[model samples]
Target: MTTADVRTVLTDGDLTVVGQIVHASNATLVCDAQVGDTVVRCVYKPVRGERPLWDFPEGTLAGREVASYLISEALGWDVVPLTVLRDGPYGPGMVQRWIDTVDPAESAAERLDLVDLCPAGSVAQGWLPVLRARDLDGDQVVLVHADDPRLQRMAVLDVVLNNADRKGGHVLEGLDGNVYGVDHGICLHQHDKLRTVLWGWSGEPVDPVLLADLDKLLRRFDGGFAEELHEHITGAEVRALQRRIGALLEHPVMPHPRGDRRIPWPAF
Candidate 1:
């Protein structure tokens, strides 16, 4: 289906709960959204199920999910999947199209996980090491990720979103051969809360093409994109988003980690 078709089904279709993503921090329901003959699998996060966060306002995570999708679209990156805010079985919530990922067990040799673990000194030829630690059996292992351009784009998107919890599990290797990021409930905060596992490109020059995309996004913000974003995030947050883009345009380089706690807990 086209992006528009998927958006229409997510926004206007009837949702029926199929199961629950039990591992999620919040109540996450897997559902099938159907409109006529079209049925799309989606994950729904109702507002009532959100856990309170000390930094973010209550009942706003759903909006922030949609807001992040908007930002990704504005960047022309498609880093985020199609997501919408709508009424569901549990109430108004975030609905995101479910991604089908390549099965690691079935395609181990062909799978390209954005983040992974390797022996302490065995980082792969195309992977970059983030840190070293002991595994469950007390064996040394290194946390690493591929040095691929797709992941680099996601890293840039995380920077722009101020994504505070980009755990490795949130980065998916879609069966369709695209890298997608998920679980963005803690993003777009007014303050700098960037936290992610994709720091391999830190201090590297930003690709010129991506800088052009940021330039385009800034122009869209001036053309009323900020107002559109204000519906989901705070006005101050929107301004902060603009400021972040402006800073990137001025510096044109990927940022290095600032102080400790830059990477999220439970990195995978």
Candidate 2:
């Protein structure tokens, strides 16, 4: 199908469930949806299926997912896939364009290289040391490619969304060789809850290109982007989203993890 067809399907498609994403914590369904004459694979996350979170209110995850996509598009990052909130087989939910990823493990491995141990300088030649551990048997450390511009944008996106659960598996490398983020159900809260695995750019200078994109988002927020989000999140959440954009524009630096719980459990 053409790009326009895919958009039409995701926008006003008749969904037919192909299977359930059994491993998903919440109810997630794999469906083949028809737009007019074209069918495209899509993922559905119904609001009723969301498990309650003490930090986030109920029935808001699906909206947050849609909000994240809007923010990504506003920033011109294109990190999140095309997503929309609409009625589904179960009820109102979020439907996203399906991204066919390469093996998750293989993609992860391609970005990381095993080293003997943490090296001096912490910052290597365009690479940054991610983690280091020592067992009785041996010592090991993993370094990630910090220079990858795509990942840098994703990190910025996580900060803007205040993403609370950016596990490794959520960072999918599509067959087209582009990275897309998924599972934004626990994102964009009014409070500070940015948990992510893309902290490789910590303490580094934010790229100029990213800063330019952020400026665009600020303009959008001032115009209608925040208003657009009212259909999904509360007024306070929308305000918080604006505040995050302002702060990032001012600082324009990879933030150091300050929260007590910086990384989400079960990182993968």
Best by TM-score: 1
lDDT of 2 at 110: 35
Off by over 4 Å in 2: 1-3, 103-127, 133-146
111-194: candidate 2 lDDT, tens digit per residue: 442112243345556665655544446644453445567777888899989999987778776888788889999998999999
Model 2: colliding residue pairs: none
Error of 1 at 171 (Å): 0.6
In lDDT terms, which candidate is top? 1
How many steric clashes does model 2 contain? 0
Alpha-carbon local distance difference test for all models: 0.92, 0.81
